[model samples]
Target: MEKDRLVRFVGKVMEESGFKVYKDFKTSRYIIDIYGVLPTIVGDMGVVVACKNYDEHWEVGLDVLKEMEMIGKTLKASKIVVITTSYFTNSASNYAGRRNIKLIDKDGLVTIAKKFSKKENEIYETNVIDENEDSETYIPSTKSSKGPSIFHAGKRSLSKSGRSKSVGRNLNLGNFMQGFKGIMSNTVALIIIVLLLSSLITYIIGLFNKNTALIGVSKILSSAILSYGLVFYADRDPNVVLTKGTIVFFVSMIIYVVLIVLL
Candidate 1:
């Protein structure tokens, strides 16, 4: 029957993804056409396959997918994979997604199969995956950072390049904002610590020295403090340098004036 050829075809494709693939695999309840073990970074994940080669341009529907889902439940499979020669209907895909079933049509299978020009034993011997790393850079036993895709190859969604190398990656505005905020916070913290420490030292010096001497010292430090903020801010962007400099200048001046009057 057509189903037999489809099972064999799916088995061949699964082999490329570093699976020990077998056709007509039997479980406790029913006979699964294909079953395989996918070695991943987290652990070995089980894949149960349902292969269909339709005679017509039939859209594999949700009803068929539900059967695969039920079968997957019994087998405790990580992925319930449905591979078809014909394309899937929209409803079928939606339903499969809801059930967490992976769907692969004729084109996806062929593309995946072609990538496996290497012999199955060679792949088994060579590939090794380690702690949650990029599957693209995986050697022996690796899994994608995201979940597994329908194909054995990494499935970076919205990226048309499938297994092909891409020139760029998506920019994340949220991450950029978070990093910027952290830098600003650290800069402000450093300024606070430095200014506070300087004030404490000035206070101790004032306690020991005469008012005239303290006033002279304060004046010199005040000029330096004012210029420090300006110079610190001058190089970078519109960072918190201006604010830091202003605070340092004003605080030093207030301390300087207070000592001159009180002493």
Candidate 2:
């Protein structure tokens, strides 16, 4: 199966097993392969599962375990599981056993797939986070205030420095949108307002100037001034300005399209 679909299958299995699951689960630290919960003898165990599809034998090693261990502690996950189509090395297995991390080889994955297939009908489908969605996201599977465990996991492909950056970065902005309107904030909101005004000004100038290049320049200048005003008022950093500005431009274009069609 394709990697995306493979992860989704893992998610479905988690659902069937009666665990709340999120596929492509992102966290402040790193992207989780699969995050879910399972009822256990002790308590509800938050699970962080990493899935790998490789042509050759994929060994879960000490490095992978250390990453998981750190992430598990960060999220308070009760268990960490790595599922791969490739076979595990002896050292890898030994390292996992010592840390209480579960390693599932090709055969093990098949077993879980078979076991969960029985409850295939009731699998809880969710809006899985896409890889390119953003650098930071940790959307919960459930909105209930009670569910607290937010498991995080990652890939060996990520550089050690990259993982550290993710772990260190703040995720407040990524998770703070109350609604579409709420997204319109600081320089982002200002850009859209100026863009609309610029559109009107450009249309008016077109009646005389007739130079498309000149009109485009005017639009850019107008947007920059407005954006600068917002940054000045909000004290937003350049990164925030750029990120929010991109969002505003696209969303405003869509809104303009809809308005034009309606008229």
Candidate 3:
């Protein structure tokens, strides 16, 4: 049988014997081969079986046997059955005998499976943590009744380091509405603002004068500034400024400078 079919068969046997089975039981990173909760029905007991599909005559390794033994004890299982198509090594059999784990070799599996084909009664209980509780029920170790220990200090310190880290987060979220409005507005006044700023800065740098270079640079800067305003407006709408947008702007700026200097 396929692994899943074999597991299903084992689980069916367990259920018939009156046990609650939990398949793919994750104790840690790896899932247990077959972890099940057996009902406490008088003489009929539940089991956890680490099922293996190896060929006959192959011996079950001691380490594999030990790991399953530990998991069985941890889960409070009455018995752990290493159900394999293969027989157990002498050391593995001795260990299982001492630990009280039942070995279900290929032949034993079919026999035992046929025996536990009836369901039994089981008791189930669960624990839950209460979220809403007064001080009478659950209290923090800290003596202060004001609030949580972490927020014990009276005021939030707005120091240089704190503000520096907080500024980026606050700007991204708190100023979102203001930034969105500024980016969307098509007031030509905003375009004029960018144009005037760029032109005045270039002029102050002595990069522009009464010559053709001055006029040419001014026009180029003015065009870029105007485009930036349009880009900002488009950004507010569904109009996207892709990754290429910044590259295009930078390249245009470089070309404009080279044209003024050479041509």
Candidate 4:
């Protein structure tokens, strides 16, 4: 199965199992393929799911389980389930067993497909798995249910489509604001802003006082600030700093000479 379809299939399975499912659930640090919550008498249990649509030969590794474990901890998930079209490595299986994480290999996937076929009256081509078969098999479902399309899973109460739309808009706005804040907070960006503002303010003050000296001082300050910025950029990429700094140096010198002659 394709990765996207596998995610949706897993989500549908979760929904069928009495859990509220969310597709492409985004967290602060990670994007969960399928997030589910199963409510019980005690409390709601969070389930973090990862879907891997690998070839039969390619086995899911220990690193994938470790990553899922970290994601589960971040989401405070009660259960971590990994469903893969392929099998799992021995180390991965051992780690999952120790961590109490549920791993569904190709055999388990076939079993799930068979169950869904029986329950939903859908036909699956890979009902029986042959040990000797080398080619890949897909379980196609005709079920119209697309599962949950929302990025977030909330209370069990059914919310209107308008609410989901609003939530999506809010999330987009929030992400844009966050990105803006990050850019503004960057040290290099702040330095550039300061250079522009200081140059403008100095020019204004010089004009008001009718003092050429203040304007000269402003040019000097701007050059110093530019040099500092160049030095900072040099730490990141020296080639960029060299090219830009050389051009800026000549340009500043020409501008300063013109100002001296004109003033």
The whole-model C-alpha lDDT of candidate 1 against the native structure comes to: 0.57
Tell me the number of clashing residue pairs for each predicted model: 7, 0, 3, 0
User: What's the lDDT for all of these models?
Assistant: 0.57, 0.57, 0.52, 0.63
Q: Report model 1's TM-score to 2 decimal places.
A: 0.45
lDDT per residue for candidate 1 within 165-209, as digits (tens), equals: 311121122223323333323434444444565666666777788
- Candidate 1 differs from the real structure by a C-alpha RMSD in angstroms, to one decimal, of 19.3
What TM value does model 4 have? Answer: 0.47
Please provide TM-scores, in order, for all candidate models, with all chains considered together.
0.45, 0.43, 0.40, 0.47
Can you list the residue pairs that collide in candidate 1?
127-140, 128-139, 128-140, 128-141, 129-140, 129-141, 129-142
In terms of lDDT, the poorest run of 10 residues in model 2 is 143-152
- The alpha-carbon deviation from the true structure for residue 173 of candidate 3, after best TM-score superposition, in angstroms, is 67
lDDT per residue as tens, model 4, 179-200: 3433332445544554565567
> Lowest summed-lDDT stretch of 10 residues in model 3?
118-127
State the lDDT at 121 in candidate 4: 42
Better of 1 and 4 by lDDT: 4
Report the number of backbone clashes for model 3: 3
Cα lDDT for residue 147, candidate 2 = 15
* Model 3 spans > 4 angstroms off: 41-46, 113-263
* Tens-digit lDDT string for candidate 3 (152-238): 112222442343344334333323432333333333434445555555666765653557677656666665655555554434222
